[model samples]
Target: MPAGTPDILACLKGRFIGIEVKKPKGGIVSPLQKLKIKQIQNAGGIAFVANSLEVVKRELSEHNLI
Candidate 1:
């Protein structure tokens, strides 16, 4: 994977998805990670940082992917 690549990458309903997984506690998103997320979003992909399965589900649902 390239620098700052998201932890999970997938294609759901034809949409590109990128998810960065972190611990529920003491998890931080670095500047590079933030930049990558933004880049993915700017390129019309769904990208975010998730600390739990609920967050991942919510994000996917928000994008109508679930």
Candidate 2:
């Protein structure tokens, strides 16, 4: 868990995935979030920063991780 951050966790296919959701504008991922994403990847998981539900779907489809 990171300070002042929401639950940046998303799971798919029995794997741990970290997701930092943001708005369509001026959305920025914090440093702690970046670290968390890296940690998730380092732990053999997927991580992403998405702007919208469509963006999430797009990422999942693009990566074939859906």
Candidate 3:
């Protein structure tokens, strides 16, 4: 995650990407966060909740952003 925020930003060959890292156990996504991610997606950007390296890779790959 980035400083003072729950999100980390990245770029995959110029495409914007945002990651929200969460715990692996019983983690929940808040409504506000969901709205934010939805905005990213609406803008053709990628957004995900990654709890591990594997999850990060999966999300990127799933979005064809990696």
Candidate 4:
């Protein structure tokens, strides 16, 4: 397993997806989490920080994975 992995992981249409979920208003992303997200993006994957289903959906939509 990769260290500092995001809360959610999946692959859609040959693209990697990583999502870090938090409370709608109070969740904080740690440094390690940021690094993980960056790593995923740098590797040509999609990464997002989401606090709700809506946020996740939006990110997916932006990536055309939904």
Strongest candidate by lDDT? 1
Position 50, candidate 2: lDDT: 83
For 3-41, candidate 2 gives per-residue lDDT tens digits of 623356666777776678888899878888788778777
lDDT of 2: 0.74
lDDT of every predicted structure (CA atoms): 0.95, 0.74, 0.77, 0.90
What digit string (tens of lDDT, one per residue) describes model 3 on residues 1-66? Answer: 423233788788788888877888877778777777778888998887788899988887887766
Q: What's the C-alpha lDDT at position 51 in model 3?
A: 81
Query: What is the C-alpha lDDT profile of model 1 across 12-46, one tens digit per residue?
Result: 89999999999999999999999999999999999
Clashing pairs in 3: none
Q: Number of clashing pairs, model 3?
A: 0
Off by over 4 Å in 1: none
- What's the best-to-worst order under TM-score? 1, 4, 3, 2
Taking all chains together, the TM-score of candidate 4 against the true structure is 0.91
Which candidate tops TM-score? Answer: 1
Question: Scored by Cα lDDT, where does model 1 land?
Answer: 0.95
TM-score, structure 3 vs. true: 0.80
For residues 1-66, what per-residue lDDT tens digits would candidate 4 score against the true structure?
A: 666799889999999999998998889899999999999999999998999899988888988888
TM, every model? 0.96, 0.75, 0.80, 0.91
